[model samples]
Target: MSIQEARAATEQYLPGLIAELKHQGLMQLEHAEPAQLCQLFRRSNAAGLLIPQQYGGLGASPRDTINVLRAVGSLCPSLAVMMTMHHHTIATIVQLGGIIPAAEDLLRSIANNQLLLASAFAEGKPGSPIFNSSLKASAVDGGFVLRGTKKPCTMSHDMDVIVAGVACTDTGGVDHQGFAVIFAEGANITREPFWKTPILRATDSNALIFNDVFVPDEMVLLAEGANAEEIEASAQEASISGLCWFQLMVGASYLGAASALVELLVCKRGVQDTHLAQLAIELEGAHQALLGTAGTLEQRQEADAGLYSQALCSRFSVQAAIERASNLAVELLGGMSFIESEQVSYLLAASRAIGFHPISRTAAAPTLADFLRNTGSTVDAPEPAHV
Candidate 1:
């Protein structure tokens, strides 16, 4: 099917899936049960919107994934995020060219609603300033051993597969160089509940401790070393979709939250709160901007296909979308916005959590800027065009 057709099909199935979550009372629950979001992930996987068909996924277009996620977030932000994390994991694996041969089986299981995955990065302690990973992995015997903790790992405890990011050490100066995307189960993993936010509590963002976990070579996705400039360059090029996909998902969440906020406002349309009215306008602006960016992403020129321009656009677009969602959420809800029951409060928190999600702005900006500077036409005095 065409990308547009795939998108439409996924959008068609989204509302019912969201309604199911709401019916299950998943919408009102606290943020500590990341596992509960499984229903939402299962539904998305059933739709097969995020994964490629060759790998047992529906292989829907990126636009399709964004639309479904937006609808899901409107009802339960936590569920939406869980779905995002799952796709992020699967997409990363796919982009890296079957990091594990079992990747196909895993995708099939995801499609069958038997497996779930989460991004296992972000530890409490600092290690790699870019990824902010504090976890340490030591190599031994036939496989590698991992020791360290990750904080705010979405659905870490409940995930069937935890994609842990670990730094490989070598004799050459602490290496911090080669990175491993280790695929392991949550069976032996210890989960310490750490999510303190009022929103996205269902994400169960907990601390994950790996005590000498053995990841076989097959389970290890050997990406270029983080410290090796050439390896990093290759990874950046290889993980294009992995890097940009989150932008679409983040925008979806913001748009979903904005929609919810507006719906709430519509209930009190004539309530004479000018501030709310203005907030509504701001939300509208954000919505339009998000849609515009989506269009830009979809319409990227073939000539520029290999360039990092799309990723650049996605990086900035995600940050701006999160900012807009937060701004309007605070304005429209006012003092009560902090209340968990408030319509936009959960969404606000989700946006905040995602704002600080993987690939922080500080880390993403310079890489994006370099791409734009290299590709963009020089604005230097317009080359004194012949008048």
Candidate 2:
């Protein structure tokens, strides 16, 4: 669908989600049981919120996804984050083209059943790189046997799919990074609870241990050898587009948290106009950055190295703006904001999750600095996948 149509369509789901939130209330929502939270989202049709209509989802574009996520964050940060994890996996798979027939059917199930996909990508032991993995995905006869663990796998309780990023080896022992989408009930998958914080207590961020899990050939998406430059190029295109969407959606999720505080500030303590105005400008800048990046994807410019740099840089900026806005709202609202409401504390913590994801400013700084000194302008990089 066209972007305008996608925007209009996604906007329709917000009222229902918001209405459900109001009925649930902040205190109850903040303290909801995991089962209740899952049911609430299901009743609110939250699972398919970002999926396109063709596949049985809301069919939201990046712009609309941002808008909807921001709105969701205003009321419920946990839900917002859970949705981001869900959308990131699904959207990335969709972005990275070349899905097999089985994967296609799984997407249909996602769209039709509103079933969730807990992201098992970019996760590993302490200090492990996000993209690199150590999963033992040994290429067997017609498929591969995977043995590893996915830490902090969100949506563990209710997800219908387990999409993990793994390092694969061919018979020739050549290595490649590929995504594995397995049915949630697929054999040999065990769940281990690991989250200890009460802030996002309801998110099912746990360990998913895969022991001799056989992933059939149809469920894998991998890049070919360097010799097949055409295939490799296509994989790179998918990777860049997928990463851009993942980063932008994450920023949107937190922006919702910041916006929640802003809404609260607007309703009470009417004298802090200056801080509010400054925050408004920052929010506007973030929105424009998101809008421009979405437009780039829509225009099919995902193959450009400059776009990768731009998208990653934009995510960092968006994150900083959201944190600044959240802090401003907290200051204007004063200590009582946190002292009076448990909800406020939740909002503050949620907004601070900016650096938790991969490619944060701290992680991407050296590359960004290199880009400035050697890559000329911000829009001229030639290595999309690396950037």
What is the per-residue lDDT of model 1 for residues 124-230, given as tens digits with 9 covering 90 to 100? 33222324446666767876777777776877766767776677767664645334554555344677878765666777777887777777666654443554565
Error of 1 at 4 (Å): 16
RMSD of each: 5.2, 5.8
TM-score of each: 0.77, 0.87
- Write model 2 residue lDDT over 1-387, tens digit each, in one string: 122232344448744667677677755776777667767666767677656677777766677777767667667778877888888677766655454447556767877776777777676344334566556687788888899988777777777788777887777878877777788775788988888888777777778888999988888766665544664666566666667777787777777677777777778856566776797887777877877887787677354556767777888888889888888888888887779887777788878875687655666666667766666664665765763
Q: Judge candidate 1 at residue 4 and give its lDDT.
A: 29
What clash pairs does model 1 have? 31-201, 31-202, 32-201, 177-225, 177-226, 177-227, 178-225
**Model 1 worst lDDT run, 10 consecutive residues:** 1-10
In order, what lDDT does every prediction score?
0.59, 0.72
